[model samples]
Target: MSLRTLTLSLLLTLLAFGPLSAAIGVPVTPATTESATATEAAALEAAREYTASLKSMTAKERRTLKREQRRAVKDALENHQDASTNTILLVILAVLLPPVAVLVYEGELNNKFWIALLLTLLFYLPGLIYALLVIFGNM
Candidate 1:
């Protein structure tokens, strides 16, 4: 079975047992009884839907779906790695020159760059810290 199928199966198992377990040791008032009945009905409906979907799909379709999921995950990981590398480079530049790092990160000479320049002129550590915070916190 695929990971998704296994996960859903586990979920179904939990849902099936949840109401029974809740009723086992607790006193069921009318409100609690109604709540449990609703929970059970919802779980049954979900199981039916899941089983129906499974029956509807062919093996080929399932394979295609899994392939698409894998591709999406791979693309996301690649994008995350690229972002981390860029952040690291920016951090290094920020430590060396705060105003220039802000300008590069902002992709223009914006007000942020001016703020960094002003901070750097007054005190080096404050500007470096501000540039680092902008690069890290914004992400």
Candidate 2:
């Protein structure tokens, strides 16, 4: 090919890749080592303050606080119990029903919902075990 034709081809190729290379700006260097140490120290100080606050509360005060919190929760739940329960049930049904319906219509019981339900029941066993552990520890 002529020099002009070769030069034009090279220019076109560079032009095509020019925007891509230009888009990749300078690489970002990480924060200085001193700044990282300061950040870690700050986080540790905040956690220590939080733990100190928790440790400052007396057992009786904590129990009374928890009891009041539970009473508030109970009152709120009582006020909206039926509506909340129905809404949760509806959401669960909506999520599980469509796939379940399809499975039943197809005469298949091996769907993900059945598997998930079984797994959830099985997972509750661990929670029961943990409760037993806590109960026996207190005895």
Candidate 3:
């Protein structure tokens, strides 16, 4: 084939496949806000149905159900307790060490350590939002 003809054919091929390549690479975004709202509504409906079912059950049956759920959770925790404990410790160390290091490095032991400890505890509840406000002031 002629050089010009070969170059033109390759350009057209690339142009045709470029969008296909992009489509293949693009990750699928989760459902939009409206779909998320619908999903939450469905979950609420399911919870209401489950609660209504529980109300119809006898006290003995309810107690048995609770016992079974507790047993299952206990068993699962026991099986994975080592890994779970390690993960929890690692996360605590990660979140705590940075602030403590900063406090010690700056030699603000009295004020900074107490504030960092308080912020770290609060972070366990409301998380980064509380930390951000405490450390950096409100955005």
Which candidate number would show the highest lDDT if scored against the true structure?
1
lDDT of 3 by residue, 28-114 (tens): 687899999999999999999989989999999999999999999999888874644543443333344535433533456666556
* TM agreement with the true structure for every prediction: 0.47, 0.28, 0.37
Clashes of each: 0, 0, 0
RMSD of each: 18.8, 22.6, 19.7
RMSD of 2: 22.6
1-139 per-residue lDDT for model 2 (tens digits):
9754564465456545655546587576899999999999999999999678768999997788789989999999888746445433433332333333323333556554454345435653333233223223333
Error of 2 at 123 (Å): 53
Residue 5 in model 2: shift from native, Å?
Answer: 26
What is candidate 1's CA lDDT for residue 90? Answer: 84
Which of 2 and 3 is the better model by lDDT?
A: 3
Model 1 TM-score is 0.47
Show the lowest summed lDDT stretch of 10 residues, model 3: 124-133
**Where does the lowest 10-residue lDDT sum fall in candidate 1?**
7-16
